[model samples]
Target chain A: MRILEYIALMAVPAVVLFAGVVMLFGGKNYFESFIKGAKEGFATAVGLLPTLVALLAAISMLRASGAIEFISSVLKEPLSALGIPSEIIPLLLTRPFSGSASSALFSDLIGNIGPDSFASLCAAVIMGSSDTVVYIISIYFSSVNIKKTRYAFPLAFVVMLFCIFFSCFICRIWFK
Target chain B: MLGKIFGIICIVSVFFGIACGNTGQLGSAVIDGASSAVTLTLALLGMMCLWSGILNVLKEAGAIKKLTVLMTPILKFFFPDAYKSGVGSEEIAANVAANLLGVGNAATPLALSAMKKLQLQNPTPEIASRDMITLAVLNTSSVSLIPSTVITLLRSSGSENPFDIIIPIWITSFTCAAMALILCRALGSATRVRTIRSKDYKSLKTQARQ
Candidate 1:
């Protein structure tokens, strides 16, 4: 299983390289297109800067103030019973509604706690696996003028529940 | 909603930091976080530039169109009405392929067009048809082949091998997507029966249109 993960790790770069090679051989004006796309990517990255900074500052202050530890201890009993590390409680609570905010929390965790730590690893998986249900629904539905979502929110919420539980369960075993 | 949480968290943390007599460290942590965010942004800029550039090359090579063609069978199975609606299937396929590559910024417009096309074919224009709902659900839970954002974060944070989480992330995301579809299909039968038995959904849809 670990070996498979190792291959998966390597495959990301391998696949990207292969894609580039294929395109280079099979396409036209490749350099111009690449430069254009690179510029757009850089611009988008620049746009994410402020939101990331503000949210991470708040999260870091909270962590240093021992607010997270305090809250974790308060919920420690119940969370441990479910095999959830208390450190990730913040992530679970915040992730469903707002994506960037949760990601801010995630980066904070990886920075404060080493990335290989159990809590950090689990946070990474949970953040990666889950969707920002409320955010996406609000944006997509409103764009299309979908006022009555009927079962959309409820069903998506159910999937989120599964995501939280299963991601915790799997991370515990995968990285344990 | 996020603003409220942010305000609440900051106020609570700073107040507690003062009480804990760690105000100085808390201030420093905030600064560190800011610096860290800059570092992360720089790293992300590099990765996104490379991937988006490669994606541009692939797009130019018509690989994405080929991918759309490859996606037709599954797209058809999920939303046959799209194929029937002339251009709807194409838009849906483009949206899904972009999503698979984790280019969500590129997928939204494609989705809006697909949704519009699907809407055009709706017998009852006010209510969302099953195909529209499926397309929306699939788009939201879209299975990403490479989670570039998460990877960039991990790499910036100094993980020995940032991409080790790839397999796990892939499995979990794909499972969620599969579960989403299964739930949609199962409820579809239930929804059909409910539509005839109750006017609540119909009224709701009419209200939305109004």
Candidate 2:
């Protein structure tokens, strides 16, 4: 199983390289296009700089302001009643805003509480399954100048709720 | 300006708390956390730029286009309305494929391009059509196969197996996608019923006019 996993991991880069080669042959201007694309990609990366800073700063503020603690306290009773650990609440709440920040929190949980713990595993799973809905809305929609996202928020929230419930249930049933 | 304001506020807040000596350790922790956050933000921005560059190269090489074609049928089922225009299907498929691969940083441009094509087909942009809403719904709940960024974090955090949660994650993702689809369809049916009722009233009015 480990060998297969390694092979799968290796396959992605191989496929990408193969695709690149295929493109090189598909057109006379393949090299030019590739260079142009790379430039555009780099430009996009530079453009995302401010949003990334803002996200990190906001995360910092939230943590510094004791907002996370306050939130955890408020959610403690309800989440614990649902069989989730208090530790997982921060990940569940923050994962949809800043993926890196949530991951940092996840790392802290794993380091402090141990990765083998059910809470860590559940947090990891929830982070993977859920999309960063708020980030997506702020970035994608705003970039496209989309003023009204009629169904977007509702759909994202519903899916997130379902994933959280289902993930918690599965973790309890299988890992427990 | 906002960043500077936030930085100042954070510093001031820390000093105020420290001067009061209300909670020395907490004040220190807050300052330390904020400074670390600035560093991490800088690092994340750098990483995003690198990934965006790679994605752009891949896209220009036509890998994205080919991948979109390969995924079109599946994408069609997910976003049926995207194909209303001639080549809109390919653009939507490409955008979605990029998004699912956790390449949303790269997918942003493709999505914008597709949205432009879609807008051209629409007569009125004031109200979203059923198809447009469906596209938005699917995009919002787009299933992820590999949680790349999460796995990276787990690996850095010393997980024995960063990808250990893959199976559970996939299961949860599919469940969410399934539910999103069902809800969209139910909502769509109600809209259809309303449309039919309105169409009937319009026909009756036409008959009265005649």
Candidate 3:
């Protein structure tokens, strides 16, 4: 476990070091290439601002209007019956759409139920395994200007549910 | 697609807000949400730019090319059409490699570039091609070698062993990625088969008329 943590900590710096060494020996101005890419990244982020605002606004509206909470409460009984811990239900509900919101729910869950509990493990696994489906779909498709996403949204949603379930199932078995 | 979903969300939320009599909260959420989005973007800008810069250097140094070559066989399985045309395979490979390292900020720009390249090869400009959908699904069910952020959060929350969940995360992520690939391949072929059957039906009708 300690070794795994060490490797995880080193991965980023190792990649940067490798890039630096290669750039140095390759006889090109690394700063120039970096600045060029950084400029593109800045432009990309700026371009995505409107999309983020639109998506986040709708999500926040859902939260503020008590829609997500209502849905979560309704599902609590059924999901808990299926062996899912109630503590992680809110996290699962928000995770497919919003990263930050889910993170907040996750920490709150750990705080409420203790960090070493089964539900917290499940939340951690879910966090590590899945990406924000709606956010990724909207950003990626809009970036390419594709209006007709065909089956992507439905398919991604289905996959997100599967991942959530799988996360809970694995954590249940492995943590025990 | 996003339009319909966004519309539904807005309408449903507004109605719910009215029913719950939290119009004031909803109004505040409207403003707060927009500001939060801007704040989040600004917060991410530095990290995104830094990784993009590093990736640029890697690309120029030919390191990305090596990763592309190594990734081609596996990527080819998931993206046969793109591989056959040789359109956006390199960018796709780079994107997947960055994602495997759990460097999402670096992966996003590569993914956007790959999408552009794939768009050029798309027969229908407004519709997502099979390769494009596959790429998006791949991103959603991303396979990561190390999920550092999750571990950090767990550690900060005072877990006895924050890394204990690593293996479970690995298993879950790999299973999701495999399932995503299978689903996309199945869905892609199902649509293609339907189109072909319809085409055949039209051809038969034309033959009979002639």
Candidate 4:
């Protein structure tokens, strides 16, 4: 953990320094290149705005309507039977769909249970290891204007489930 | 598939909430969701531009090329089709590099760029190719060496050992990424086989007619 923390703290600075030194010796016009890329980024963000609005609204609706909570409650028993802590089920359900919602659920979990508990640890690990699959898939695909995401959706969902279960399992052993 | 799911979820949520007499919350949720999306995008926009600028500088300096060279062996295993095609490999490498470096903001822009490049090589423009799916799955599985956000949240919440879960996260992230890659490869190959068989069947029928 000490070494990991050190690496995390230093990674950004190290990479930036390395890039700067390389650019200096490489004789590239750094500012021009940066501006060009920044323009591309601006386009990407603007292009994604519509999709973000739609996706986030739907996810929030699911949450606001109590659907996510309802779904999590129904799955709580079976998930707990499979060794998932019932307390973490809400985060698990929400994490794959929306980042903000999951983070909210995560803090709620940590706040309710305290940070050092097994469930909170699991939540942290889960949140760290996985991502908002639907969001990533939609944004990435839509950014490229690819409407037919054939198998990406199903494959991503499958992996999301795997990550959730695996994160809990690893946390159980590692934190224990 | 995703659009359908989103539509269904939205419709069901609206109806369910109204039926359950939570119409006020549902209305607010829709407004909040859209508003938050705007806020999130605004926040992400600057970071995306900043990181994109830096990454482009790195690319111009050939730093990313060197990193891609170093990553080839591992990337080859994960992105076989992209490597073989010799297209979008650079963006893929850059995207993966950003992801490994734990720069989420940079990763998204790089990933979107990579997806665009991959689309160039896509035979079917409307449909995603296998490599595109692989990239998305890879991102979804999240191979971040340091999950800085989670750590920040944990630290802010006053955890005694905030970094304690790093090892577990590293393990789980790697496992999930590997599993996702393998699953995509397996599924991709299965679909390929079916497509090939269909092509053969069509060719056979044409030969018979001739």
**DockQ for each of the predicted structures, in order?**
0.61, 0.35, 0.47, 0.48
In DockQ, how does model 2 score against the reference complex? 0.35
- Per residue, candidate 2 scores C-alpha lDDT tens digits across B6-103 of 45545644554455443345545545554654444444444444444445555555656677778776556655566645656666777777866556
TM-score, ranked from best to worst: 1, 2, 3, 4
Report the interface RMSD that candidate 3 achieves against the true structure, in angstroms. 5.9
* Superior by DockQ: candidate 2 or candidate 3: 3
Candidate 3: where is the Cα deviation over 4 Å? A1-74, B1-64, B193-210
Runs of candidate 4 with Cα error greater than 4 angstroms are: A1-74, A145-147, B1-66, B196-210
Q: What shift in Å separates residue B207 of candidate 1 from its native position after superposition?
A: 14
Backbone Cα, N, C clashes tallied per candidate: 0, 0, 0, 0
For model 3 the local lDDT of residue B157 reads: 64
- Is candidate 1 or 2 superior in lDDT? 1
Candidate 1 local Cα displacement, residue B63, angstroms: 2.5
Q: Which 10 consecutive positions of candidate 1 chain B have the poorest summed lDDT?
A: B192-201
List the candidates ranked by DockQ, beginning with the highest.
Answer: 1, 4, 3, 2
In order, candidate lDDTs are 0.78, 0.61, 0.78, 0.76
Residue-by-residue lDDT tens digits, candidate 4, A1-176: 66866765575567567667765776756778878877887787677778667766776777678666666688878988776777787677567777666665575567558889988998898898888998889988988888888789988888888778888888877766
**Candidate 3 residue lDDT tens string, B131-184:** 899999989986876676566567666787776777788889999988888889
Estimate TM-scores for all models: 0.89, 0.71, 0.68, 0.68
lDDT at A120 for candidate 1?
84
